[model samples]
Target: MMERPVRKHVRLKHYDYNQNGGYFITICTRGRIPLFREGDRLSAAGMIARACAEEISNHFPEIVVDLYCIMPDHVHFLFMAVGTPYMASVRSNPTISKVVQQYKAAVSRRIGRPVWQRSFYDHIIRNPTDLEETRRYIAQNPLKRMNSNG
Candidate 1:
């Protein structure tokens, strides 16, 4: 069998992902296949993925889910890590990587197979303006997709 080519690491080096901040993340399906829709509603796999995303709050108290959109082939979501001294705890210790891993793992398990690409894409939201821009981008993804298809 032919070996797969190694993928380059896209995450920023020397960055502390566990630090308090907001992150915009995009996770695509393996091979960029559209597997999340059945007519106008979400498929079983899509529903499972959505559940896993929502379940992040239960697993990590410091992470808040905001402004997420699940497209036919990918998902875009914002995560806010509330890393205050009062909120810091062993149980809630999770970096952005850990959060994505747990979410992908949960969805894979529920679907009985892996459906995600090897790694996800993320952008650190630097300020309120950045956050709002990313939020708007994510919210409008479906319309963009619709327009593109038409």
Candidate 2:
């Protein structure tokens, strides 16, 4: 089920993106194809994915890099609300949502096409243990992408 970068057709949902917590999020391409998977190797799409991963590192100076990975089709992040957020939180908040929207905007601008799904998945980190584990997962995602046996 793959398509082009969808427009902001769907209504945005409510989310709690701030509130002093760590977050683990995964975003996919339009549909669920391997936009990130290419052969037994990474594709140029992977570079696009990398662009996404490098985002927080290169975003509004306030953006911080907790942990992240860019798969051929999806991206994961273990980021936190450092200082003030990108956008304020709404009932169906667009704080983290804005992060995702910005990611899509950048990808689209770079690829000359929309390269992300209309929405993303996010989970606020609950504890230190889960936080560490999630970070490890994000860090190891590249190896998993590179190795079938990994």
Which candidate's TM-score is highest? 1
Off by over 4 Å in 1: 1-4, 85-92
**Candidate 1 lDDT, 17-135, residue by residue in tens:** 88888999999999999898876578988898888888888988889998788888889989999855334354444889999998988988999998999889999999999999998
How accurate locally, in lDDT, is each candidate? Answer: 0.87, 0.68
Candidates in order, TM-scores: namely: 0.90, 0.70
Worst 10 residues of 2 by lDDT: 85-94
Record all residue pairs in model 2 with backbone atoms less than 3 Å apart, i.e. clashing. Answer: 14-92, 15-93, 35-72, 36-72, 36-73
Number of backbone collisions per candidate: 0, 5
The model with the greatest lDDT is 1
Residues 38-101 of candidate 2 have per-residue lDDT tens digits of 7656577777666666865466444466877767678788777665533447332236667667
Off by over 4 Å in 2: 1-15, 84-94, 144-150
Q: How far out, in Å, is residue 124 in model 1?
A: 0.4
Q: State the RMSD for candidate 1.
A: 2.4
